[model samples]
Target: MINILKGMKDRHSDDVKKYDFIMDTAKKIFSKYNFEKIITPILEETELFRRSVGDETDVVSKEMYDFIDKGGRSVTMRPEGTAGVVRAYLEAGFHKADPIVKWYYNGPMYRYEAPQKGRYREFHQVGTEVFGIRNPYLDAEIIKMGCDFLEELGIKDLTVELNSLGNVESRKRYINDLKDFMAQRFDKLSEDSKRRYEKNPLRALDSKDKGDQEQFKDAPKLYDYLDEESREYFEEMKKYLEIMGISYKENPKLVRGLDYYSDTVFEIKSDKLGAQSTVLAGGRYDRLLEIMGKVKIPGIGFAAGMERIAMLMDDSLIKEEKKGVYIIYFNETKEYFIKIADIMRQNNIKINFDYNPKSFNAQIKKANKINVEYVIILGEEEKDENIVTLKNFITGEQKKYSVDEVVNIIK
Candidate 1:
C-alpha cells in the first residue's frame, strides 16, 4: 500500500478549522487596510526566481523545485509569493494602468528542503505588497498591519527588528568591506556562508553558524554604511513606527535572505517560535522591479508563514466550529431518512445521516463519537407518522417534532 508522501500533510478536523480561522482573520484585517486580494498561479517560469530572488540565495540555489515541463518550458512551483506577484503585475499591464496598488495573496509555496515542526516543504503564506509607494508612513503602516494581524490571531511576544539595506551604492560599499573581513577567516565560515561570501556577503550576517555569527561581532555594521538618503529614510520610518505605537528595536544585521531587498527591512519575531522565531518578515524592494525588467517601481511588503502563525496561536483562541446535527435511522427507513436529511440540508441546516441503516444503539454510538449537538431518530414508527424524535445531545432530552418543526428548532 502506498502511504502519504513525506513532508506532506492532510489537514482535517481541527487542523482545517484552524487554517480557516487564520485565512478568515487575514482577509478581515487585509480588507481593513484596503489591500485587494490577488491570486497568482502556483507555477511560473523558473527564471522569475533566478532573476528576482537572486541566484545566490538559498531559496533559489538550494530549495527551488524547477523543471522543464511537458511542453518543454522551464517552470517552477513558486518558492515564495512576492516574485510571482511582481510577474503578475507586469504581465497584466498593472505597471502602466495601475502604477500604485495594495494587493495581498493567500497560497501555498513549495520548497524542496527538509521539513521540520513549523517548517514544511509545502507551506502556506498570506502576504501583502504595496507597489509604487515609498512613503515612510506606509512602511510603519505595513509593519503595524503585520503586528495587528498577529494580534488578531492571539500570537503575542512579538519583537520587531528593523534595519536598512541602503541603496545599490551604499550596499556595494558595505559588501566590499564585509567580503574583505569575511575572507580573513573563510575556512571558519559555514559551507552555506562561505558560498554566500563572494556573491552575497550580506547574507552571512543572517548565518546560523556559531563561527559565522562570532565573526560578525567585530564586523562593519550595515547601519553605519547607510548613505545620507537611506539614513534619512530609515530615520523617518522609525519615527513613524514610534508615533504609531509599534515598538521596535534596531538590528544592524537584519539583512533578509533575498537579493531584491533594499532600504528599510524589518522582521517580527516571536519568542514562542523556538529557533525559527521570525513569524513574519519583509523589506523594501526598491530595486527589485528595476532588476527584473529595468522598470523602476518601489515596493514594500511582508509574508507570514501560515503554519508558523498557527504554531504560535493558542488552541482556545482558534474557535472550533460547532458540530451540527447527525441523523440515525433503521434499515427499513433508509430511503426515507436520506430524503429527510436532504430536506433538512435544503433548509440551511448542517445534517449528517447514517448511510447504511444500523441498529438504533449502534447509530447513536456513531453520533456520540461525532459529538453532534442533536440527533434525529427515524425508526419505523417515526417513519410511518412522518415525524421524528430529536434528541439533544447536551440536554439529553427527546421530543417528537414534525419535519418543519425540526428545521425551525435546529435553525
Candidate 2:
C-alpha cells in the first residue's frame, strides 16, 4: 500500500520550490502591468463550469471532479479560472467600483484525467483576467503580458498560435455551415467527435480524431465566416502584435474548448515539450461578463500553466534564495533555544533548524544537506564564552563572535 501511494506525488521538494518561484515571478510581472490579485474558492457550484466551459467540453463532461456537498448541492473543483473570476466579479460588485478590472490568480485546479507529463488530476495555473474592455489594444496588451512572462522564465522556441473565433454573427453562420458539412461525415467521425457534433460541432474541429483532422483540411475555415467588422478587429490585433515584434501563426482551427470566447483566441506552444504542448492559453471573452450577468462589458485575458512552464525549463534553475544562517545547536541547549531563535527572527535574518533533536554530528550533516550559505555552531565553548562560531559553508572559513557580534555579522 505504501509503495503504491509513494509512486503518486503531491509534488517533490524540488518541484515545489520551482512552483513557488514561478508563482512569485508571475505575480511580479502581473503587478508591473497593474494587474491586481484575486483568488476564488477551489470548489464552486457545478453548473458554473457546465455553463461557461461548455457542456460538450471534456472538462465539463468527463474530467471535472464533482460531487454533492453536505448540503446536497452539487459542487465541483474549478477546472479553469475565467468562470470563477466572472462569478466573483458579479458576486462582489467590482464592476461598479472599477470600470476596468484586471486580476491575477495562482492555484491548483482539479480535473479527473489520466496523469501524464504535464496533465494531472491536480495542477497549478497562473491566470490573469481583464474585464470591461473590448479594444483590440487590450487584447494585444494581454498577449504581450503572457509573452513577457515566458521571456522572464528563460523559455524560448515558443510560437504563439493565434485565432479569432469571430463574433456571434460569424459563429452562427459558421456553425450552420459546419453542421451541414459534418452531417455527411457523421459516420466517419470517431465516437467522441460524433458526440461532440451533437453538442458543439465547432469543437469537432479541435478533435484529435485522425478522420476529423483529414476532413478539416478541406473544410471551410472560420475566417471565411468572419463578418467585415470582426475581420477588421482581428487585422488590427495582428498589426499590434507585429509592431511589438510578437510572431504568431493564424491557426483558424484552434478553437478553444469553451463557449465564452468570442474573438482573438491564442495558445503559446514550445517545441521542447512534445505534441500536447501549450504553456499558455487564453483570449478575448467579449461576452463572459454579459453572460454571467455582471454587465455588458467585454474583455481579454490569458492563463499560463505553471507546471508546463516548469516542465520546459531546467528544474535546477528555480531554487529559493539561501538563508543567511543554518543553526546548529546541541540537544542539551533546549532551554535557550527559543531565545536564540527569537533573536535571529526579530533581526530579519532567515535561519533553518529542524526541531527534532539529533547528535551534533548528525545535525552538521543535516545542515550540509539543506545547503545554506552559513552555519552557526552553539557548542559548549561558544555558549561558555557567550559567543557563537560562524562557519561559511561555501568558503570553509570560520570565525567566533559575541552574541551582539553574531547579530551584526548576520544582519
- Candidate 2 runs further than 4 Å off: 1-8, 323-338, 352-373, 394-396
**1-411 per-residue lDDT for model 2 (tens digits):** 345331135777778788877888888889999998998999999989887787777888898989999999999989888889889888888788876888999888888878876667777889999888888877887888898888778787789999989888889888889888888778888887788776877788888778889987777899999998889999999999899889989988899655667989999888885664778988888887777774787878888878788888766566556566878887666556667778888998888887885887888898898888788888777766767788888899999987778888777
- Candidate 1 clash figure, as a count: 0
Full-model lDDT, candidate 1: 0.87
| Candidate 1, 55-172: lDDT as tens digits | 7777888899899999999999999999999888887777787689999998899998998987888899999999989888899999999999999888887899999988888888
lDDT of 2 at 162: 90
All candidates: TM-score: 0.94, 0.90
For candidate 1, list the clashing residue pairs, or say none. none
Report the Cα lDDT for residue 198, model 1: 76
